[model samples]
Every structure is written in structure tokens, then in C-alpha cells.
Target chain A: MLSAGIDIGSRTIECVVIEDGAIREIRQAPTTFDPRGQIENVLAGVSFDRIMATGYGRNLFEVAYDAKTVTEIKAYGRGARHLFPEATTILDIGGQDSKCIILGPGGKVQRFEMNDRCAAGTGKFLEVMAEALNFSLEEFGPSALKAGKVLTINAMCTVFAESEVTSLISRGENREDIALGLHLAVVKRAAGMIRRLWPGGPIFFAGGVARNSCIQHLLEKDLQVPVIVPDNPQMVGALGAALLLEEGA
Target chain B: MFGLFGSATPNSNERYGMTIYDDHYLGGIEERVIRDTETARAAGAKVVGVYCAFTPKELIAAAGAIPVALCSGSDFPIPLAEQHLPRNLCALIKSSYGHAIGDSCPYFRATDLLIADATCDGKKKMFELLGRKRPLYLLQLPQTSATAESHAYWLGELRRIKVILEEETGTVITDDAIRKQIRLYNRLRTIVHEAFLLNTGPIPLLSGRELDTVTSVAGFELNLETRIAEITAALGEIKERDKDDDYIASVAGRPRILLTGCPTTNRKVLHLLEDCGGIVVAMESCGGLKTVGGLVPEQGDPLKNLAANYLSIPCACMTPNKARLDLLLAIIRDYRIDGVVELTWDGCHTYNVESFQVEECVQATGLPYLHVITDYSENDTGQLKTRIEAFLELLN
Candidate 1:
């Protein structure tokens, strides 16, 4: 039997199809204002017996496609455990939100915390700061890794941090140093959320933001723990959903 | 004098395949209440507005006046209130003050007098400003309810407010009148408490929103007998529906949630919780179990009895608020609650700080607990939906 899972997020859409308990195909698309059209585009040729949806726009997908729905928290917990069988904690910094999940024995979600009603410490924050610094998203993380001394960016708000970034640029500050500071600010907020949950063992980092090497390196340095980023980090939610359907969970 | 008769319609939840009996006879009473308050005022009946649960409603009734709750629970007037108040203040305080100064709340416009208390520093200072616009009377409440001196001081405040009520309404408030009002209010509390307890069944007969609507709308009712009759009728209908086996089967198996914290006047969080698939079986806030859990002694001096009963409420304003924790644990067990969700408004320092102790106490019971700190805004609905859904998943 084959199962399909789709994650319709604020920034992107991911579709994962699995057969015989292994990933068969993975597809992705950018979710503009017309997410329904984007969703149709991503799943044009994928075929599966059972399908599930998860993420910010999962409800819309459920209504439009008559599919089952699960929250991203449960999906991440299941997905991370499937990839690394011994994993007990997971962090996902997506487009507009970040969540830290602590799993109990058998991969049941024990406790979790998410950023409240803001885009301060997520991929959206990085995207905005990258634009303000005139750096492409692909080069933003690699550029930040080259900085020597990090300048402090105290404001975590996206709007305020953008203005702060502009001021730092005007002050003849190195763009690389300011970029590193912005990355550190995001890492600081994410670390605070993880620490509050009292996580132990290795942290399984997923979602679009996990692709940034600077955030992963800074997170390890700040928390003094090993951070694991899976390949195709953005596909974790969709992969988890498909895997959960296979297990009938 | 608000008309009590209205067309009643039962709200159906298609998800559960059941029809929830709606006792919404009290809906749309605001305009009628305003018009009625005007007519009654012209006929020499006084209307007393109050902001906290500490003020004795019986005293206002005994003085031949109507008691209306003036605490603001909306986000509409908050920006207007921010012109004079700080933007960082509690939304409840800001909304209440905004309603008074903006001349928007019909209830505030109808009140001949306003009674407030020193529950917290924010509310106390805001009341000072509110006094400038209306005939406001501040009740000097004792900080601690665990002392004999505190009880005496509270009794003195009640007596002082009683005198003010009499002077303002030009009515003689005798001990007999006080006792009569006490009996009437005690009955009202008993009936309302009984209605709230119906949710303790294996399947709740009324949803949380329905329970909230019934209790809050009933407060606008000035005629005690009519209010009691309407609620009693609604409760009876619910009980009658509970006897049906099919009705019970459809609503069963949802996680039962108990809400505890600041007054859930805005109800955004409450709606979100239910919409996320958890039934809020009990609420321990001011408008819920906290204010209605106890009754005053009928045989004692009325003012002292009122003081003792009202003082014993376990608000976070008290230093050693063990009573609140004790009440929470008891309700958790009695309601068979599957989880606890504590809602605290932003800048409500007392409840905000008290949530730490509440979390520790709740976790010790081996049940899941979630503490939501928010303001009266819809900006966080998406985030709140994810949190609430995830919390409910934890229960499963």
C-alpha cells in the first residue's frame, strides 16, 4: 500500500509519497497567495492509496481534498522518531512559527512550547532580515558564517530588527557581522523556547529554517548539545504525515 | 425592567450529530436594558454599576437599586482608553475605562453610581480616573483574607458602601431588607451553580459557550425572580435532554477541559479551546466557579456574613492564595477533567505571576496543563489554534 502526505504551509507546500514503508517520491512548490493552485501543482502526478495533511493551511487542504488532518507537532514528533529511532525531542522553525516538542517513550508527545503569535524567530524573520541586508536567501547563512565579531541585534521583532539592520548598515558596520547578529538573535529566541521545555538528549531540528548552517551551529554552541538536521528538512512534516498513515496512527 | 421574553432556537453541532438546547432568552437585552434603565431611573429607581466580584451585589439590591456589571470584556474601546491610559496596562482595565470615558457603554451611561475596589494597582489607579467622569465609590478592600483584622476591615468597607448606597438612592437599607436580598442572591447562586454542575456528567448536556452565555446574560436581568425562573427553565430543559441515550452518545468521548485564571470575559480563548475539539467542562474564573462556589451564612449579621463570604474568594490578589489551588484540585477531581488550561491576560501581573504556582500544582496531579498568556486581540488566533490543538493531542 502507498500513502501520501502534504504539508501546506504559509511559505511553501511539500508532498511526500511512501510505498513499502520507504519514501518513493517527494515534490515541492512555493505557496503564493493562491495556495490551492500551488497545492494542485505540487501533487499533479503523485499517486497513493491513503493521504493526510498537516501544517498552517492543512484545514484548507482538508476541505478542498477530503483528506485527514493532523497538527504539525504530532507530525514532527512521529517524523523525527522514524528518522532517528532513539530521538526524544524535536524543534521545527518553519516559515512563520517555531515549536519545541519533547517526546516520551514510544514517541508520544509529552510536552511542547511554540512562539506566541509572532514571526520573530522563524524563517520569515530571517527572510526579512536577509532582504534588508540585500542578500539572497541562499547566500544569507553562508555569508553570516564568515563574520569575525557579531554585532548585537537586540530587537527580535521583524519590523524593528529590519530598521536596526538598516541603522547598522549606515554605521559602516560589516554586512557579514550584522548578518551574524541577526542569525544570533533568532537562535537566542529558539534556544530560550527549547530550554524552557527542559529538553535532554539530542535535538532533532526540522523545517525550512534548519537548512541555515549558522543557526544550527549557533544553536549547538548556545545549548551545549548536539543538534541533528535531517536531509530535506522541509519535507519532515509531510514525511511524518505519510509515515503516520502507514502505521495507522 | 428588560423584557425577558424572546424567540429561542436550539444550536445544532453537526460534528457531534446532536442539537444543543439553547437557553438564550437573555440575548439582545442590551437595548431593552438601556431603555428600561432610563424608564426606571425616571421613576426613581437607582442603578449601581460595579467592576469586581468583591463588591456585594446584595447590598446594592438592598438599597433599592439595580446592580450591573461594568467590567469591559471587549477590544473595541481599548484604543480610545489608551489615549489616557498606558498601552501596557491590562486590557480589562483599559477596556473598562474606555467604555466609561468614551460614553459608549449603555450600562455605564445608565448607572447612577459606580462601585469599585482596590483589587490590583492597575485597577485602583484606573478607578481614580474613572471617578473623575462618574459618581465613583471606591471600596477599601483588605489585601489579605486570612486575618481577623482583615475580615473586620472588610466588614467595615461593606458597611461604608451600604451607607453610600442608601444615601445615593434615598432609601432606608434596614437589616430585614439586607437579609431578604441575601436570601434571594443565595438562591440565584445555588441555581446557577446547579446549572454549571450539569456538565459533570459523562457527557456534557451544554457546551462551554452555552454555559457562558447563560451565566453572563443572566447577570443583566434586574428582576431576581424572572432571572431565576429563566435559568431554572433552561436547566430543566437540559436535564430533560440528558435522559436521552442518543443525545449522550453523540457528545461523549471528547477531552474534558477545566479553565482557571483571569476572568474569561473576552472568550476568544474559550471559543478556541472548544473549536479545537475539547469541551470546557468547568471554569474557575470570577464569572465561573470562583465567585459561585460558596454561600454566606444566613443567621449572622448580614454585612459581616457578606464580608466573610466575599473575602474568601481565592483571587490572585491575596498573598497566600492556597485557597485557589485547593479549589482547583477539588474541581479537577469532581469534574473528571482530562486537562487544565489557564488563561491570563497580558499585563495582569497577579494572575500572570500566579500561573507559575498554578502550573506546579496542576502538574503534580499527573494531568496535562497549558498556560496561555494573551491580550484581547485576534492577531494571535492562528498561533492559539496550533497551541490548543497540540494540547488536545497531548490528552489523546
Candidate 2:
């Protein structure tokens, strides 16, 4: 049996196809203000026995296959359990938000902490910081590991943080050190969320931006846990959707 | 249909007083009320309490204190807030001066100490920001109370706040005292909640927005129980709209959205939302319960009752241990709400804290959320009209 999954996010979308528990095809796209056309394009050439949608915009569109949609959190948890059974805590950071999901011994999501109210500590936040430091998000996570001394980025507002970053820049601060400072500030925000949930782990980092070495390096250092990133972590939500289709199938 | 203000409407009855909602400006009503509220130095009302409707703040009365609604003092600015929070933080915080600490307004000289709580993140920081004053009491709340454990945790915190005030104010808070206050408060709350009830019930003399004024101002008076009793009776006499009036909505956001920076007087804004459909049967706002009055403290260690009432009502302000907006949303669910018109003020970071969370929650409730960014001033009709038309266009 063939199955298809669409993961609509606050800022991006992903679609995956699976046949009898084996992966077939997957495509990812930015969740724009107008993503329907792109969404249709991503789902192209993907004919399936069943179609399921999930995430913030899961219900926005109708697909050809029999419809079933779950929350992105639930899908992420289920997918994580299937991929990395030892992932006690699944920290999925998407475009507009980040969440800390605690899994029980049974691999079910027991307790979760999410910061969706503000865009202070997510991929978009990272993207803005990237622009401020004259680096790509691809360089954000690792750039921090090279820091000699860490500085604190004070502002939570993206605009304010940029200005702060600029002032520090004009002050002739070391670029790598400044990047480390920013990485710390954003990490502190996530750390606060994790501290609240108080999850036990081998924490799993799953999201497109999670691939960044700076976010990963700092997360592992500050958290004192092995922060594991899935191969193609961005597809975790959609992959979760696909796996759920298999389990029920 | 005629507005559910009063009986004998239109040109038919000249004596029919207008509902405050039938107004040219929100600040105009506030100005009128503030005008009624003589300055503390002039009023000579001994022992007043600054009321923020996060919880029952009547405890100050039990301590032989008077309750005052902590509105903006014309002369004061959020110096303390600016010290810690950004300059672009909301005006409510900027103007939260004097209320947290004494302000230039003479109304503050009467305040013995400020009582506050972290019902939300913003208010939590407000308490921290205001902590420089040292006399404030900040209460904390659980994020989710749906579970038995979380409920007990929050309720236990509420109980602890009662104890702390007993120690600080030296007001003996007995069970009888609290039970009595709770009964009176429960009555007031029920009545006030009923007024905003969307299920075709008798509209209380106030709406959620108006509750802020009634509750906050009425807390200061000595004869609160009597005043509330009289007001409750008056509210009963007011008319209830025949059918489900207009926009039945669920107002959601971070709890501490007090401090009215801008005054809104746009019925078209309300009407546009209504015409878009759904009478705004309920919402959470400072102009609502935070200032509006409710909860009659049972005549007792009046101080404890004051504190108790502050703990009960919901606030959009970020107060500790308070999801006042969340609680309000749960209460208003009986009205069968369809959408939410999140009327926001520009530069109001307080409400922005939970705006997105609120939108997501409303979507979970199977409703659309219309983010109507407006200032307290009701002059942005064209912008509001466009936004409302575009947003409402989605619901259709």
C-alpha cells in the first residue's frame, strides 16, 4: 500500500511518500503566506493509497487520498519513537516555534513544553541572527564552537537584537565571539523552556534549522546531553506523518 | 434589533440612559469615571487598595484598607518598567507607574503597599520590575490546570497567598472569613460572568470590557458588598438581547493586558466584527474584568477577601500562576463562540506575549482569529474596517 503525508508548519511545509514502511519520495517547501501552489507542486508525482495531513495548517487543504490529520506534536512524537526509539526527549524547532516533548518509557509523549506564543527562539529567530552576524544559517550552529569568549545577546525582540548585534559589531568585537554570544542567547531561551519541562534525555533535535552546527553545539554544551540530529531532520514531522500511516495500515 | 441596553428604547423614551457601550470613546467613559474618582488626596477616603483584576484584591480591605483601581496617573511614566523592559514594551506597562509603586498621581499617596501577581509572563516580569518597591505580593499559577495535579497546585498557591497576606497585613484570615468572602465573591462573579454569558442570558450591567472599570473602581469603596448588591440588581433590570445578539467570540491572550494605553470608541469596529457575524459575547481585556468590578467579598477579615477576589478573576496581564485569559475562554465557551476579534493596541507587548498562542487555541476550538491591531483611540476606523472586512471575509 502507498501512503502520502503533508506536514504544514507555522512557516514551512513538507510532504513524504511511503510504500509498505519503506520510503519512496519526499519534498520540502517554505510555508509562505501563499503556500497552496507550492504545496501542490511538492505533492506532485505522489499518488498514494492514502493521504494524511498534519500541523498548524493541516486542515487548510483537501487531498485526494482518504484524509486523516493529527497535530504536529503528536506526529513528531510518533515519528521520533519509530526512528530513534531511545529519544526520550524530542525537541522539534520549526520555523515560527520550538517545543520540548518528553517521552515516557513507552515512547509516548508524556509531557511537552512549547513556545509558540513568541518568535523569540526558533528557526526564524536563527535566520535573523544569521543575517546579523554575516553568516548563513548553515554556519550558525558551528560558528559558536569556535568562540574564545562568549557574549550575551540581551534583546528578545528580533529587531532589537539586530541592533545590539550591530553595535557589538561596530565595537570591533570578534565575529566568531559575537556569533557565540548570539547562539548563547537563543540557546538560553530554549534552555528555559527545557528547564520548565524538565525532560530526561538523549535529546533529539529534529527540524530543518536543527541541522545548523551552532545551535547543535551550544545545545549539547549547555544542556550537557547528546543532542542527536536525525538525517534530514526537517522531514521529521512529515516523516512522522508517513510512519503513522504505516503503523495504522 | 435594538441594543440590549435598557427597556423603552429609541425616541420613545427620553429618560433611557445610554449604555456606556453607546459612546464616542472608551477613554471618554474612563475620563468620566476617573473624574468621578476624586484624587486620593482630595477624596479623604482612608485606606484604599490599587486593584488589578487578576485575582480577588479585597484582602487589603480586611487589613482595614481601601481598594483602588491601579489606572494610569497622568503625571507618572513607567520609569521602573523602562529600566527593565524595553522602551517599546506596551503603554499599559509604561503607564503602570504609580500603580506598582506610588506615582505622581495623588491617588497613590493613599496606597500603603502594592499587591500583584505573575498571572502571565509579562506580569511576572512586571512584578520583578516592580519588586524594587519591595512591598508587592506576587502570586504564581500553573500553566495547565486541566489535570488534577495542576489544579491542586494552583489552588494550593491561591491558599498560600491568603496566608502570606495574613502575615504581612496582620489580618487574621479564618476559614469562616474566607468562606464568607468566597460566597459573596462567587455571587458577584456569577452575576458578572452571566452578563457576559453568550447563551442568551440576562446581560449583566457590564460586559467583559466594562467589568474592568466596575470591578477595579468598586473595590475601593467601603460599602462594596452593598454597592455590588445594588449593581447586581441594577444589572438584572437591564435588557438582554432577544436572540444571540452579535459576534459570540472567545477573547484569548497572555493574561495581564491591563493599562488602557488607548481608548477605543468604534461601534463600527464592534459592528463590523458583528456584521461579519458573532456578537462579541465575551473577551479578556483590561477594559473588561481587570478594571470592571465583580466578586463581593463576604464581610470578614476584609483584607483576605480583597486578596481572595484578586486571585479569582482572570487577567490578561502576565501575572504569576494566572492564565486569567485561559480561564475566561473556558468560561465563555458555553456561548458557542465562532471567532475572536483580538483587538490590540499598538506597542502593547503585554497582549502580544500570548496573541499567537491564543490564536492557536481558538483554532483548536474550531474558530477563526481576527487580529485587529488598534490603539486605545478609536480613530483608525478605515484600517480597522479593512482588516475586519478582510478577516471576516475569511469566515464567510
Candidate 3:
């Protein structure tokens, strides 16, 4: 039977459609304040035999869709295993939160550390940094790569990051390098999360920001490992939801 | 008030301007807050009666007790406590001479009875630390708004308060009495709510630094009705009066990130945030906001005011994380928050598992958030500043 997983995050809503146990399609959209409306909108073209929802807004959507809801930790664990089957630590970074999930060699979640209360290590921080730099996020990595020497990006808050970025810009620093500096700052933020969960490495990074080349290069450099992303990185959680539901069935 | 279970002595020690109790002991926290022989005297205070120095003595009147937070002698440094707690533990708990090897707060030393709330884990420990000194009237509160159980739990605690106060102090709490206190609190909350509302809300922001001075008054007796009146008046007078001056933050979990998890809120970190072009308008965890609701329980039953108060605030540990998130979210939304900083204390269970989940929720709003892990000691001030500046720079 076909199953689906819906992840309604704080700033994004994602859906994964699975057919015959192989992932079929995944879709994502900005999570609106009214997640119910956003969920309805994101799933307009999708049909499913069974549905499970997850994330911070999991319960809200469960009540709306009358669907089974699973924790993001469960969904992410399943999704990460599918994407990086041999990976031990699946670091899933979303818009507002980051999860450093530990997996046994069997790919089940052993322990996980979640940074949900702050935005420093997630996509939202990147967007804020991107806006501050006045460069499309597409420009972030390449520009950062060009920096001869990296200037320090102080201030972890998205609000203050913008001000600091503007100051850096006005200081006549190359915008690209500054963007790289911000990327490094986020990497540093992620590192703190990584250390706390103490997931021994060979880590796999996932999330929408995983598509960004700049972040990929920077992250790979930071961890000194070959970083990988799923074919459709955004739907990893949704895919896990469908997978988890199927397993239970 | 004099005949309520303990000895009452009206003799004031001239040097300290306190009613010295003859039986004051020096072995525990309770003995430090109050001593025997001075139960009715105003030298000692109940912890519950004072959430902050700025909370006002009217709260004491409403709660039917004197609000005396210990503020004497040295800043009691619990080597173990200081090892774990942020420098932000309420000034009263840290500043008093009470945490000595065997000494309790003289105010608690003198008092007949008292009340305290589990607003923070440290304060909860204070209940035990001081309880060893005296049986503290407990409020399992100052919790976050997420758990429905909190409301029920708090109302129950308040009910216990009503019964216990009635039995112990020989003064039963009536619904009318509670409603009367509620009205006063509501009025005060309204005023306080209004104070944060002035300047179109969340203006004239005080740093955690400046606000610490206000919280230092938490150690003062809540019966200083005059002080409450003075604060009310002073708040009204500031032209740049910012009703929304939320400076406290609860930074939870570990990783030695500066200024994260609940620090009992003090001037230093608040000063740090403000100095870094940031303001701690809200807490990412149960750190700063627990004191807001622990003042009175507001559940369906007025009798369990204490419990009700505890259950109403925002906490991260409860089942329904939404209510807790919403409470902090409302503060962020209301305070016009520019950014959020997460403090992860080194060895907390409930928060460490879900700290990132909390970080994700806040980040989803497109707000600026930073995560720091610390052992919550004051020793690593410089490294914390560098990280703070770096995090602030990220916002630019």
C-alpha cells in the first residue's frame, strides 16, 4: 500500500510519497504560520493510503488530517538510515532546528541531540545571512571560497548577524568571503550541537540547505569527511514517516 | 502572625536592622533565611513571596506572608552550586551568607513558616537546601505553559498551600481570600502587564544586568508594601518606561556555550547581551519566565493558587511542548525579539535531549538564535564573550 509522511516544521512543510516501499516523490513549501493551511496546500497533488505527520507542528496536523503522527526524531532516524545507510550520525538541519541523531550500526536512533530553541544552526540562519549579504544564497558558497583570509563573524543571533554582516560589508570586506565567514559561523554552531550529542563521526548532513554548494564545501572541510546528501534531501523526514508507518503496519 | 507555630521575638539587632532570633542556627539554608525567636518580625521572608526584587511586597500581602529574600553578608558561593549554576542564580540565593557549610538564611532562621516554588531547578534545590534548614512551603511551579498537567499540578499545590497554611499557620486560605489575592496579583500583573505594555510594549529594555538589580530585591521582605508602592510609582514615572523589559532567560543543557540555559538571571549576562548589541527579551527555555507565573496559581480552583501559578508558565519538560513553546513564542512575538540565544547547561536531562528541538522551533520563525553549552560556571567569561561576539556577528 502507498503511504505518506508529512513534516510541518516551524518554517517549512514537507511531504514524501512512497510507492511499493521505494520512495516515489517528495515536495516542500514554506511552512506558514497557519500550518494547517500550508499542509493542505503542500499536499494538493498527493494522494496516499496511509499518512503520518511529524515535527514541531506534528500534533496540529495530526488533528487536522486525522493521520498518525510520529516524532521527528523517529522520522529523521528512518530517513537518515535510508539516505546514508552506513552513517552513524545523521545531522539533520531544518529551518529553525538542528538534530544530531546517533544511530547504532543497524541505523536505528540510539541517541539524538536537538537544537530547537535557537536558530543559529539551521536554514533560517542561512537565509538571514543570505539576506544580510544581499546575495542570493546561491552566491554564498562560491563567494566564501574566494576569500583570501576569513574575517571573524561574531554574533550568533540572526538579528545581530544581519547588523554584523552589514558592518562587515561597510568595512569593505569582500561580500563573498563574509558570506563564507557566516557559513563557518553556522558550521561552528552545528559543531557545538554535534559535540553535545557525541555521535562519533562519518556524519551525513541533510536538509534543504544541503543543496547549497557553499555550505557543503564548508561543512565537508569542517568535518574533514566526504559529506553526502539524499537525492531529494528535503523529503527525508517525510520518507521516514511513510517508512515508519509501513513498519508498524 | 506571632503565634503561628514558631517563636516570635521583636528584638532588632541594631547593626543589621533585623529582628534577631534567639534560636538562629548556622547549619542550613532555612536557618540562613530565618532564625528562631523572630517569626513575626519582618527580618525573614518566604521565597515564594518574592520572585524578584521588583515583584513588590503587595505579593506578600496577597499571599498572607512577609516577603523576605535573604540579602546579607557575602554572596554565598556554593562551590558545588557555583560549579554548576550560572552566575545568574538569583542574587538572593547567591548573595546571602546562607549557603555556608551549616548556616541557613537568618530570615528563614526566624520565620514561623514560608513558601517556595520550583521556578527553576536551582530554586527547587534551594527548596531542598533551605528545607533541610526548614520545611519550605513548596510550590512545584514557575514552570512553562506546555503541560496541561502543570495547571492541575499547580492548582493541587495551591490547594495544599491553602490547607497547609490553614493548618500550619492556623490561617486557612479561603476562595475569597485567594480571589482577593488573585485580584491583587491580577491588578499587579495587569500593572506589570501594563508596564511591559507601555511605549507600545517591550520598550525601555533593561539588560539582564539592569534587571538583576531589580531581582536582587527578590531577597527583600515582600511585606515592604512601601517598596512595592515605590516600584509601581517608579515604573509609572519613567518617560521611556518600557513595560516589556524582559531580561531573564533560562539557558538549558550543556556544551559550554556562554549565556545559555537558565542562569537564575543576573546583571552580567544581561550586560553581556546588551553590550553585544543584543537584549534578552525572552528565554529559550524555562529559564527566565517561570517567575512570571509562580507568583499565583490561576487554575480553575482559586484555592490551589500556588499550584495553579506553577502550571501556567512555560516549561520545556512537559508532554505538550506546544503550550510551553507558545508561551515563549508569545514573549518573542510580543517583545519584538531581534534574536534568541540558547544556553545549554552541561548536565541537564530533560532539556539536553530536546534542546535542538527547541532550537529548531525558534529558528523556524526566521528569528536569530545561537546555541552555547557551558558548565554554568563564571570561570569561562572570556571565551563566552568571543562566542557571543561571533554569534552577534552572524546576525549582521
Q: Give lDDT per model, in order.
A: 0.87, 0.58, 0.56
Q: What TM-score does the predicted chain A of each candidate obtain versus native chain A? A: 0.98, 0.92, 0.92
Candidate 2 stretches with Cα past 4 Å from truth are A62-68, A245-249, B1-396
Docking class of 3: incorrect
How do the residues B40-135 of candidate 3 rate in per-residue lDDT, one tens digit apiece? 444432333233222223334444555555433233344434554455554434443134323444444444555665544555665565555455
Candidate 1, residues B1-396, lDDT tens digits: the string is: 111111111223432222222324455567768887888899999998999999999999888898999887899999999999999999999999999999999889999889998999899999999999988999998889989999989988988888888899999899889899999989988988897788877777776776676667557877788778877876776787567775566456668999999988888898788777777888999978998879878897888888999998899998789999999999998888999999999999999999999999999999999999899999998888889999999998
Off by over 4 Å in 1: B1-11, B14-24
In model 2, the fraction of reference contacts reproduced equals 0.00
DockQ of 2: 0.02
> What's each prediction's clash count?
0, 77, 119
Candidates 1 and 3, the one with greater DockQ? 1
**Predicted structure 1, TM vs. truth:** 0.95
Real contacts recovered, all predictions? 0.70, 0.00, 0.00
Number of the top-ranking candidate, with lDDT as the measure? 1
Ten residues in a row with the worst lDDT in model 3 chain A? Answer: A109-118
Q: Candidate 3: fnat, from 0 to 1?
A: 0.00
Q: List model 2 lDDT by residue over B283-308, tens digit each.
A: 45544433334554556654444444
